[model samples]
Structure formats: C-alpha cells, structure tokens
Target: TKMRSNGRIQLHSEDPHQLVFEALLNRGTPGVIAVDDFVLKDGRCDNETYGTCDFESDTCGWQLHNWERVTSQRISLPATDRSTRSPSGYFALAKAPGGRMVSPLKWYHAAKHRCLRFWFFISGTSSERLNVTSVVDEDQEKSLWYGAASEASIQQWFSASVNLPAQEKTPMVVFDAATSGNPGSAVAVDDISLGNTPCPPPGSCSFDEDTCNWYNAGDLTNAQWYRHRGATVSNLTGVQLDHTLGSKEGYYLLLDAEDTSARSLGSMQSEALTLGPAVCFRLYYVMRQNSGASLSVGFLDEHHYLDGRATTVKATTPSQWTLLQVERTELPPMFTIIITGRTEQGSSDIAIDDIDVRSGRCTTAETDPEASMPPTTEADSPATSHVTEPMPSKQPAPPEVVTWQSKTTAAPATTEPLPPVVCKRGEFKCRTENTCIPGSLLCDGVYDCLDGLDEKCESGAQCKENEFFCVTRTPSACQPRSMLCDGQEDCVGGSDEALCGACPAYFC
Candidate 1:
C-alpha cells in the first residue's frame, strides 16, 4: 500500500511488527514509514496490559520488543513527534531495574539523505540513560544520542531528530534504554520516524552525537575541566580535590586543581564561533578557594594573538550563582573562547554554567568624539596676574544692622552624615555591618562579628587546620608559611612564633 503525504491510516493487526514491516518493505511505495503511538497497548488500557507494547512478526527479520505501555497520569507525555501524529497513548521501557530493550536492525543502502526522529520522556535521577547507536561497515558502532535520567519533578517528552550520514557499508539503527532502579523513573518513547532532512544543532554542541561544548585543552595532568551533575569535590582527601555542591542549575563545568602541587594551569575552551557586532555574552560562575587563581576569556584575531582583547576576573566565593557579562563592540571574523584557570602552588575548584552568547548591542552609550582645538601659545597670557580695580567706596557704608533669625524659622534640620567605614588593607566588608574583619578571621571557626557573618564560609580551603592566619595586616600572611617559624619574630603579635610548632614538619 502506497502512503500519501499528510495521510492517516489505521491498520488492524494483532501483530504490530508485521504491519511495520509491510509499510517499510512494501514494493512500489518508496515513502516514509511513521509510527504514531506504540502499536502494542494504549495508555488508557488497564494495568493488565501494562507490560505488553511489543510484538513479533514473521514478515519482519527480527523480534520487536523492549518498550511497554504506561499511563499518561504518571507523566504528561507527548502524543506525537510532530503535529502529523497526535492524541496518541503513552509507552515506556520495561520498568524492571537494569532492564533494557533493543530495536531490530535493518540495513539501508548508503544514501546522503537519512534521518531519524522520535519523542522521548525521561524521569527519576541521573542514573537513567537512553542511547541510540548505529552500526556501519558491519562492526563499527556510532552513538547517536545519550541522555541521563531527568530529575525534574514534572516529566515532559522531548523531541529529537538526528541525521544519519551515508557510509561505505549499509547502516542500521538501534534504540537502547536502561532503568535506574526507580519505579517512578518513567522512560517513554513514541512517534518513531525516518526522513531525508538533516537534524538541527544540539544547542551549542556541534552535533547531536557529540559530547558537551566546553572541553579541556591545556595540561590534563596538572588540572582539567570535569563534567559534574552538582558542585561537589571528589571523595578522596589525600588526592586533595575539593568538590562542591551542584551548580543548582543542572549540569555545570568544573576546573579542579586540588591535586596539583606546583603552579599549574587549566584551560577550558568553548566551541569556535563567529560573533557579530556588539554581542552580549553572559555566564554564571562560582569560585571556591580563590587564592592565587583567576579565570579569563579572550578573542584571537587572524594573526593568532595580535589585536585580541581579554577580560579576567579574580575568584570570589559568591553566595550562589554569580552573573558575569562582557560586551564586545569590535567584531572578529572568527573567535575561539578560551577560559583559563591559573594556579599558584595551590587553589580550589572553579565552576561555570549557563553560558549565553547572542546577537545584540551593548546597553552602554557610545562615547563622544574628541573636540578639535588649536594649540595654545604662551603669548595668549600675561606674565603677571591681571587684577580689576575695585570702585572706591564712598565713605564707609552705613553700619549694616544684622538681623538674627528665630530658631523656629531655622533652615530645615540637617543631621551630620555618618563616616564611611573604611576596612583595613587586607580585609573585606562583613555582610552584617560596615565592620571590617581580617580575611583570615573569616571562615576561621571564630565568630568575629556579632551577627557571625564573618564565620559564614564555604567549605574547602587550602589552609591547614593548625595554621594561624594574620589577615589584619597588609599582604595577609599565614604562620609557618611566613618568617614566623624560622626563629625570627616576623609578626608584630608574635603569632608566627607562637604557631611555629603548628607548621608542617617539611616546612621546618
């Protein structure tokens, strides 16, 4: 039977796989084979038909199973991949833990126009993953898509369309799904289709089959960018990696240097982009232990490094995700985003996410052009100051009678302005008040402020437990790391001498 464009037909068959094969392999009908809903059981069916969304057909080469029926009440599933098919029912993978299903592989001759489209719903946690792989040249396998389980409270079906490139040998596609042990982890798929058009770009990613956009480029041994579900440090302390909690905004990129002993550099670069004039670039970033660390981004011109400008920001612990925006007026033919992390001996992890680069002019106004003027000459002015002669006062003016204003009629009451709270050279302002406290006293387990704002600190610093911090002075110094442990009274309060034994054995 030949399928017409934008046509709908319902075939009655106990074996759904047989119908699919008849539609795909039927002679004289070189058209697309589309499946609206899982042919097995609809979502409205009773629980008795819950695990029966699969069937076998003698006409088809292989078995067709793996997906099962699920009710729409559990999830707000999409009824269609495109508007062409809708009002469909729900279907999901076998909920059994570690259970998986694979679709029958069919061979297709090499063709430039090959694409696959489908709608899928994922729930539970990050443990649940769905992957689509294809094989060409008999043994070579290529992954098309990989998605972890969703943590979102409300599960929504997402549509995906991918391109299938021609190969030297025929290609076959397979759909794979795995359960993460959660009964609520609903993994539903519907509206399978094949087409000739190319797939859309996966957000900032180059292709739907590739990994994320940001990647490590510098010395991987010293430090590297890591993908994390949340902002967290590694488990092993001896390795000296400090993990943070999640970015609170889903997936994030992290640059860690806890393991590196000496000065190291970690560079995470973004995909190459051709930027337009006056684009606003924004991203959210977090800095754990900022000491001796910095993050920067720059644009490279055609001459590699010539005519490029970079902006760098020092690390600071923000209470939550912090926004950083950069506006560039000059447009480059092409540019690569380079985010480099520099570490001096020791540093904490740095994380960034929610990167957005779009077309738009900056909000700031353009500067006025310089005014044109002639050069001034010394002849324009006299050597001595010019004075005007005061008119001779006729006799002494009559004694002026001063009128005294009444207190009630005094000018509006004005209070004296409070003095600005100036902090010491090495300290920061406390959230509680304008009070300045030593940076060392901050997060030192001691409540330096009445409100204890100074003590509110984020975990994971490079300092040792026994080390003494003298943050009140210029160039904040740490005991034992300074002149204190060498039998010299370097600190005015002798804190360096007092904490001499606290210094590490190697330092002595």
Candidate 2:
C-alpha cells in the first residue's frame, strides 16, 4: 500500500515478520515469502505510536516474518561473495550498558527541516549524571540544546518528536547523559526519518505553511505552547547536560533544596555593562512545577564593574511559560543578559529551555545619525556665564536680606535610603531591598533583610559582616576546599587553595 502523508505504515498481519520485507517463516503455519538482498539506510523512528523508536529493519534477501517462512531470495545489500541472509552479519557496533541490539535509540536532525522524530527502547543507566544528546555538526566541543529527563524506570520504550530548527543541516544522532547514566542499562533505537510538513495551528485561518506563518506564527503569542516552572521561576528553558539538574539555561541562581549553584554563563549577567546599538533578544523556557515565580531582566551601563558584572536577578512573570522579549536603545553591541529565579525562598526542581537572541534597528530618535559629536570648542562658548542680557558688570547692588519665612513645611522624611541589593551589577535593579544582602546580616548575628533577604543567602555565600575574613584570621583547620565559603581560599599560605567555588550559580 502507498504511504499517504498522514497515514502510517501499518503492519497488521498474523505473521510477525511480515514487516521484515523478506523473511522465512520456518517454524509456523502462516509463513512469509523471503525476498532477496536489501540495504537499510540511516534509520530510526521517534513517532509516538512506535513506543521507543529505532532502526530494526534488516536489508537482506532473508527477511523476518515472525519466524514463519522463507521464500524469494533476491533483495539484500551488495554483500561479499559470502552473502548469506544471516543475522550473523548484524552485530552490535557500539554497546553502552543496557543497550538492545534490536532497537537502538538514535537522534538526528535535518539539514533544512522543521521536525525531528524517533523511537527507542531505553534501559536505565547506572549513573544519575548520564544522558544521550542529539548533536549537529559534531561540535563535540559544544552544542546548544540539552536538558534533563523525567523518568527513571528502564526497559519499556517511548517515542520522542523534538522540534527541529528550520535552518540546519541533517544532524547526527547521539545518546547523551542528561538522565541517569545507567552504565549498566542498554538502549535500542529504530526507524529513523524526518520531514518538514505544514503543521496546522490551532484556531487559525491562514493556510500558508511555506513560511510556517500558520496563524499563531506570531512570535511568542501562544501561551499554552510555553512551559513554566512555578517553583523554579524561570524565564526561559535551559539546556540540561551531564547529570546535574535544575533551572540552567540562561538562568543562574541557587536552588532552595540544595546548596549547589547553577552557573549557566548565559545567566551570569552583568548590570553595568555596555551593549553595541541595535540590541534585542528572545529566550524560551519550560517550567517543571507550579508555584510562586519572580525573575529579573535588565541591561547595564558603565557605572559599576568593581568586582565584576556577574549578576543575575529574578525578573518578570512567574508560574507561566514565556518568551522574554527584550529591546535596548543606543546599546553597545556586546551586552549580556542575566536572569535569575528563587521560588519563594525554599523550592527546587524548576525547568528551563530554549533561549534565543534577536536584534533590530533603532529609530532616529533612539539612535541619531550623528552618533558622535565633537567637544565644544572655545568658539562656541558664551562670553558670560549667566544670561542676564550681559548685565553682569552693570548689575545693581541687590543686597538680598534673607527674609526667614518659616512656613511650617513638613520636613522630608530623613530615613536613609535603603541600600541597593544589586542583584545584577550595573544592569538589573535592586528592586527587592536587601535581596542580595549585606555581608553583615548574613552571619553578623543580625537580621538584615527586613524582607528577610539576609537569611536567604544564595550560593551559600554566608560570610556575614564582621566575620573572620581571610584578611586577618588565617585558617587553623585544614580543609581541601575553602571553609570560608566566600568563593575564596581562607588559608593564608593558600593551602586550602583548591577550586573552592566550583559550584554553578543557578541552583540554590
């Protein structure tokens, strides 16, 4: 039967090996005719119905019809003179623990397409920090999309259909370690395929799929498509890699459940930095839970970079998925973004995904044509400082007797302006007073954050004010890492000089 665009390749025969093309039902009454030489190409299936997807088809004149019959022998690959339709030719090339030779899980992307799909039989890995990744260009050095998993059980299989980029080449398949690394478990992949078909958007009147302008193609308008983590309070989805999990992508903050931090470079932002003009960006994220949410987003000027500009703050919108739309005017070209989320003080397991940056031009008012103007020369200076019609020399002697008019003006409240929390250095706002906390309150036996930000020490940097700073009190006890926890070694002689702050900044 011809494969229709929407219709799936259905296998509905009593013979198990019917889908095997050429097979010999040597042990059953309802047998199948075995065909000849055939070779399978890059294959896999991530379609949902297929359960776990993989390439299981054997391209030999001898096919499989559920151990039933052997018929015609004329459809296999150009094998050596020893072209035996034998399973012996098929051997497990690379075996990871718990790998199934039947259906090996493989991931791939199209060079220029829209969707990626596949199926695989997956076994649990022994290592928790294990994952299988889909790679493009084999930048083994670096890739963009990566993230964590949801389940732990193994053996049973599932299909996955990841959305592919509209502008990339056919990608290679990879088994990453985002989920638990079951060095002991085996994974099977099968039936690999890809295509760029028009996806009818929900409630749309447009039919033009060429540009994928399918109705809601309006950038970031669909709220349902967006995922959120009420607890993690993320603005965008983060790429999960290795085993360590939490709000990672374009977000950096401490997780309430654990003392470790996630220092995703994208989120390690600077407040007072400069950006070249024509600045803009868009970020996507998937939240794992529903809870309180508060994030931050802002640019930086050239004000403060004393220590560094590595600052991130909780920005707008919590408990909902969103594409943070950012724009800047007259910004330097190379500015950065720092987004942070701390769910109401004591929560973890937030999800994040898909972060992208785009730019556009500024209007004349925002960025005038004459970008630079020369300093005023002496020729442009006025002879007199005051504009009193040049009446400075002839000004009458106006002895002004200061008449004290004491209208009972209410004195402005003299309360000291609260210190800026400085979540994001020169860029983001100290909106939440005491958010970053002063070193004093953290360990100074004093309560600093009236809002209790002092107690909420992120990154476990709990060096309170007036505490034993490495400045004077050297370490008496010997700890491999810095016991001070100020991201610095406390040993006067640099004994505890190991990499102390190896902690990422996103996890609390």
Candidate 3:
C-alpha cells in the first residue's frame, strides 16, 4: 500500500491485507501525546475548557467575555479572519490591559528530554505582549518565552519550544497576555503540546537576534554591554569599534565604557552550557584603551567557581581585531562564559563578536595564573604601574599586554584635584554624572545617566521635534521615527522595535 497524490491510500492487495493494515493502523505509531490544542467547538467558549479566562468561566472558555473597561456589545474573536484559526478558533487574552488566561494544570514526570511546544498569533496597532511561563515548582516559575507588542500589518504566527528541566513532577504551563485597549492589540494562542525531546542551546550568537540568552550583571544602570549593529556611540577616543556601522563583521556586542563616571564595571554572561566530554570557546575582541581600563574573560563552573584571565592593553594599543581563545579539558555538569570589563572614567570602547562554543578541548594545556590565584591582601600587591609616554611617529604599535596574575599592579593613586572633567570629541558631559557620552547616544535609545536624566529629553524640547520618544528608554532620548521597526534596534532598550513585536531590548 502507498499514499496517493489524491490524498487516498492505495492498497495493492485484497481483503486479508486490508484486515492486517486496519489492525496495524489501529495500534498506531507511538508519538508525542496531544496535551492541549486550544480548539473551540461550535464557536462556543464554555465551562469545560482546556484554557480558562480570569473573567466569567461559563461565558468563554479561552477568552474574556467582555472588555471590563469598555461597554461594547460586540464580542472579540482572537483573529478577524476565521480562516486563520488553528482549528475553528483560539484562546485570546482579554482586550483590556492586564488580561490573563490560565491553562489547566497537568502532571508530568520530569526528565531532561521533556519539552513544550506552542504557536501564537500577534498583531494590531498596539500589539499585545505575551508571556509564557512554566511552573516547575510552587516557588520556581520560569519564563520560557516573552513577546512584545507588535504593529504588523497582518497577524503573525510564531512557534516556540522550551526545554523542561531534568527532574521534577507536576509540571504546569501558563499563558498570560497584556492588553493595550486597542483592537490592533490582539494576542491569541493555539497548538500547545508537550513531547519527550530536549531543546538544544544555541552554540553561537552574532548579536543578530537579541542577546542570545546572555544576561547582564554588575553596574547595570550606568555601564554595560549593548547589542550593536546600527546606532551611535559617544565619549570615544582613538580608533573605536563602529557602533552604528558595525565591526569587521556586520553586528557585534559593544561595551561603551568610555566617558562614564569614576569607575564602571560590568560583565555579560552566556546561558548555562551542558558540556560534552570537552569544550573549547573562542571569540574576537577589539578594545579602545585608556589608562586604567581592563577586560577579563572567564568561565563559571557548576559549583559557581570562577576561573578567569585578566589582561590590560597599553593605553595606545592599536584598535584592531584580536582573537582570544580558551578551552577546558575537564568538563563539568554545566558552565557559562563571562566577559567582564572595567574602566576608570570612560576610556574603553570594546567590541566582541564571533563567539563560538563547540565540543572540543584546547590544543595545548595552557595554565592561567589568574584562574588559580589565592585570596590575598591588597597591601601585598605589586607596585603601581608607571607607563611612559610613547614617542610620536617614532613609536611603533606595542603588542597587547595581558596580566594573568591573580593580583594586578594597581595604577598609582591620584592626588591631583579631580579637575572639571573633559569629554572626548563628538561627546558631551552628563553634567549629573560628569561622564562624557557620544552626541548620537544622547538620545539613541539607552539611558546613559546615574540620575536618570539622560532619558528625560522631551519630544519637542531636548529631542528634535521630528524624532519620536521611547517612553521607557532610559534618558528617554529621541530617535527618528524611520529607525523604529526598521529591522534594527536603535533605541537603547530596543523600545523602538517593541511595538513591532521584538522585546526586552538589551541595555546595560
């Protein structure tokens, strides 16, 4: 027997074979179980629903009966066109702001291979926000997916997958949608299921889509790395990585530490990696220098053990692409790579790209002294560094200087008065923080201030009249409306694209 193009099965044999085929079909093939598909029957939403709304459960199974805020007579369907419905209809959150829908809880034996899959529709002027969370345990709720408001011309369907943890029972899932009070702000969901398959982590990210699961910590408010493709930068000297035009590669991660206050320290970490027998990590980095700026790269073991190497280049080290490589032979249960940058004043513009984490070990057994440094008193540290000025024209570019010792020789303390700070070319002083930042960054999308003053520019005031305001952008700077939803994040927190369905834009 074979499947025909006309959508029928052709049985080459007769009655005896038909009996056997029917029996085999009845037994069926083992596959993923259908947990919940969110299908509505007879266009009716009633009490015995797989998904229940927060409002009256008897009136609607998967959606709110009415807008709690508005007195409208018409009931809203998840989508305008019934043809787009997954089966007949889908569960849409209430149109009113803060609407929520809870999926019925289910019990499942926990294993590493258990995974969740779902499809959702997002569209309208005030595209609604959707949050998908899994309740692994009472206190341990994990956010598996988040989608921002979108402004697409038509409804869009997105399929998402999430990997469940290795061991746990009573796993339940929930879908919540936020409303914007506009018909265009519609959030609908369908096709949710569970399977015995694990989702694999991305082996690399080029800053092409979000931060690729990297999280930021340390000095988050005033200093940190941001995904850079196009947008401007400030307070930079010498040859700095292109903030808007991009690096040698089109997109890269940037840390604009130049022009900040006294001391700025920040780090970006990758998602947890379940290592193979061995692992090797490689990345390319470029750093513009200042007197006290330094960058460190390391990995955190499953035991929260930090093994890192710190290196500081000369103040005049040429800004060019440099490859940094490291590997670990003895693999652990899980580990994450962390890149930390430190600077006194804003003197570093660092860019990183082509992060490749693969299954392999280092070519050579290289020992990092900083990785094994014992905790010691700062008083026993090496003497402060005394850098000599390089001769103009006669001085050739010096090689990058890496300090792997656990303890770095501190720069001599300054006794001279902290004079009125000066900003570099094409920069301005954040009078409040006394940090100089780029003119383009003044209102590009990020808040570049400690007092939150940078984002305070009014649309018709500090921000150009023609520019649009990212209400949530720190320092709430102005950006040309053309940059909004043009496929690249121009606003610091990515508020520019939030209304177009990209979300939680990265900011330090």
Highest lDDT scorer: 3
Residue 128, model 2: Cα distance from true site in angstroms? 30
Please count the clashing residue pairs in each candidate, in the order shown: 9, 126, 12
Q: What's the true lDDT of residue 44 in model 1?
A: 32
* lDDT winner between candidates 1 and 3: 3
What does the lDDT come to for candidate 1?
0.42
The whole-model lDDT of each prediction reads 0.42, 0.27, 0.44
Candidate 1: clashing pairs of residues:
230-246, 231-244, 231-245, 231-246, 232-243, 232-244, 233-242, 233-243, 233-244
The Cα RMSD in angstroms, rounded to one decimal, for candidate 1 relative to the true structure is 30.5
- Give the per-residue lDDT digits (tens) of candidate 1, residues 1-508: 1111232233344664553335433243222346454444442322121212211111122222555544454444333322223344334444545444443344334555454555566666555667667666557776765554432223444445555766665566665667665555656565554544343222122111222334454222335565544335531111221112222334456555453422255655544344554455545555543366655655433212212234556654332344445556665644445566565433555655545554454344322122111121223211211111111111121111100000011121245334345342234455467665544455567776778865443331444676555432111224445453566433322334444344324335
Tell me the tens digit of each residue's lDDT in model 2 across 1-508.
Answer: 0001222232334554524333444342222233345333333323433332222223111121121111113212111111122333221112322221211222332444343333333333222222233344546422222211112121222233334444354444343332232343433333333435322111111111111111100011111111212233232323242111223222212223221222111122321122245544333332324434333333422211111111122322333333333444455423334344343323333333333322343212221121111122223122111111110111122111100010111222445343223232112122255243212123234454455533342322444333322211112111223244454333332222222444324224
Across 1-508, the per-residue lDDT of candidate 3 in tens digits comes to 1101111111233345322212222123221222223332344333232222222112233323332311112434343222123233323445556665544444345655454545555554333567666676679876655654331212334444455556556555566667666754566555444545343233344554344445463222335577665332543533334322334335667766552432255567665465544666655556554345555555554322342222233333445444455555655545556676665545556666656666665454443321121122223111221121111111122112101110112322344233445433223346677765443444445676677555454332556656876432222335577876676544333445544542223332
Instruction: Choose the strongest candidate by TM-score.
Output: 3
Off by over 4 Å in 3: 1-203, 219-222, 230-232, 235-249, 259-262, 289-291, 307-317, 363-508
Candidate 2: residue 93 lDDT (0-100): 19
Report the error of model 1 at residue 216, Å: 1.7
Query: What's the CA RMSD for each of the models?
Result: 30.5, 26.1, 21.4
- Pairwise lDDT winner, candidates 2 and 3: 3
